[model samples]
Target: MLIPYGTYNDDIRADIRAFGELLDKQAEAEAWIKQFDEKAASAREKIKTAVKDGETVGIYELRSQEFYVLGDNWGRGGQVIYNALKLTPPPAVKEVVDANTPPKLISQEVLPQFAADHMFVTTYETKQEDKDKFFGNAVYKNLPAVKNNHIYEMTFEQMYYYDPLAIEGQLDLVVEQLLAHQAK
Candidate 1:
């Protein structure tokens, strides 16, 4: 069972192997992360105030049907909108997760236990047909975002980068889509 990067296969044996000392060293890194959590949390509160309170936002990686949350103990460029908008991210799961990791993949055969008020589906491919197939898949079509018609397609270039400019772009795109969805 070879699970590709950025994708998880439930049928495959879980890779729960230990990282030993490297894992232990993360404690020092976590301390640094804690310093910025305050700012991110504050930004989140303001974003929530602007939008309907308690509405969740999630970015669904279309290539693998995985959901990207603010993983680990740090905030990254890709999560700026979610933090600024204070959208409720998927509930944090307690596990040994690495930073900047790919999302938690949900099997295509199973309905996601989590849903979002606005779901952004992103992929590296540019073809609409490819996107259509992914979004049209059974489990994806049944997601609350798809069912509510709040699903928005985002290109890989728009959502995949983590540099300052890319972060700004992602934030802008998110605002535009969310506003459009709100209008609809």
Candidate 2:
């Protein structure tokens, strides 16, 4: 999904809640819900505008096939595309295979099955190394996304967890990258 670059606090909070539920961590989920609600209450108007602006956003859950929300830097430009779409109206949430389903080792054959229209954010020691590792292999070449050059790379530090605002800031950069790719 494509979304504009912006903060989707509500969506983020929901994800936190869903994450807690996925792990059966009710306490953590409740805490996240409370925090998110407080934040939303304080900025309802801003969020409403974000939803209407048609920003590109993408949402996905960890170890799940479903995409959740498109704001913040948890993923790549897909999040931005998702955020833009959120402004207009929310989309139906779909369930993807999660860790609860089963554990399948990720490999070259498995990789193509996960290829998406937009690439998810990932990192390596360096840009060239990342390309060599992911793009340099024959198995990876079979993936449609790989062939289309839809993958993105970032530093591990950028992908690490942080406060909501910090995450949003990083997402802005991700949006910029997405726009750049579109221009190219």
Candidate 3:
């Protein structure tokens, strides 16, 4: 869905390939891309100040409350947000991921002591009932994040993306919650 910049600013080519007019306004296209970079840089600096350095935030993300904990190696939207915030998952949760370097199957049981200050849940539209039941369970009700009421519910469409727009939107929520968590 995106072009790597490694091959002579390939996204420029990708845009021009998809929208032929950009070929005639290559400089303008580059400038537009630069705008995104500047905005992103500004957001990063803001997050840095708000979140504080060396804040190894405890984050838990899953499509369902079925106990899988995704990691930075997943390349999913949660991973992208985690990378942007420069946050790392706590060791208590890290040891639960599938035992592989840059693991692909990042599913494991959620410990009752699931060590995270915040939880972001994105699930299927039809599975809301199932989600209610799963989270209603005693095991999940006892999780640290859950007990703290740090659970944040979001939709699949709002997340599950990797583009700049999606990243910015996700950060708006995830970072705000991070800041809120810090305040508590």
Candidate 4:
């Protein structure tokens, strides 16, 4: 199940409830509500269409196998992948493994195998040196991703800690790197 790890405001929930109420055929305003739903659906489709054009998108995270489904507001990485898939000439997407997952923690492994084809690592400043040291060592040299030089690193502050408004900027960097290194 997809879980939202962030805050949820009452106003958003209220808005959603109100929208649902409008869907009731028994309501006297059903006709207008239907029109609204149609319009809203059309707008959503437009956004999806825009995404299909190679627009850089961002979300919090993604599930292991279903890249298209996204968590409400917390799946920043998932949003980006969904958008990429909507593209006419879709950009290559790599599944984002949760850093806190047991398997990922135990073996320091990213999953789905294909994700390793173009892996990106983002970490805090305090951990950057250690991460760099470890990945730079000979032991890391034997890993498939590292051996092929497919792993790229970026700062967590740049990718995740900054203002939410900056997520698109981070995604631009990710898209560029993925496009450049996709085949290699």
For TM-score, the strongest prediction is 3
lDDT of each: 0.50, 0.42, 0.52, 0.37
What is the alpha-carbon lDDT of model 4 when measured against the actual structure? Answer: 0.37
Model 2, CA-based lDDT: 0.42
The window of 10 residues in a row where model 4 has the poorest summed lDDT is: 97-106
- Candidate 1's C-alpha runs over 4 A off are 1-51, 64-77, 92-100, 125-130
Can you tell me which runs of candidate 2 are displaced by over 4 Å?
A: 1-11, 14-105, 124-133
Tally clashes: model 1: 0
Report the lDDT of model 2 for residue 96.
Answer: 24
Error of 4 at 149 (Å): 2.6
lDDT of 4 by residue, 69-103 (tens): 11222233332333323222112121222221111
> What is the TM-score (0 to 1) of candidate 3?
0.58
List RMSD in Å for every model shown: 9.3, 11.2, 6.0, 10.6
The local lDDT score (0 to 100) that residue 54 gets in candidate 4 is 30
Worst lDDT run of 10 residues, candidate 1, spans 9-18
Residues 1-184, candidate 2, lDDT per residue (tens digit)? 3434323333555556655766899797787657645543444343343222432222222222211222333343322333322222122211122111221234445544444444444443344555465556787566554465544554445654444444455555555554455555
lDDT of 3 by residue, 38-67 (tens): 655666776665444543344344444344
Tell me the lDDT of model 2 at 9.
36
TM-score of each candidate structure, all chains considered together: 0.57, 0.45, 0.58, 0.42
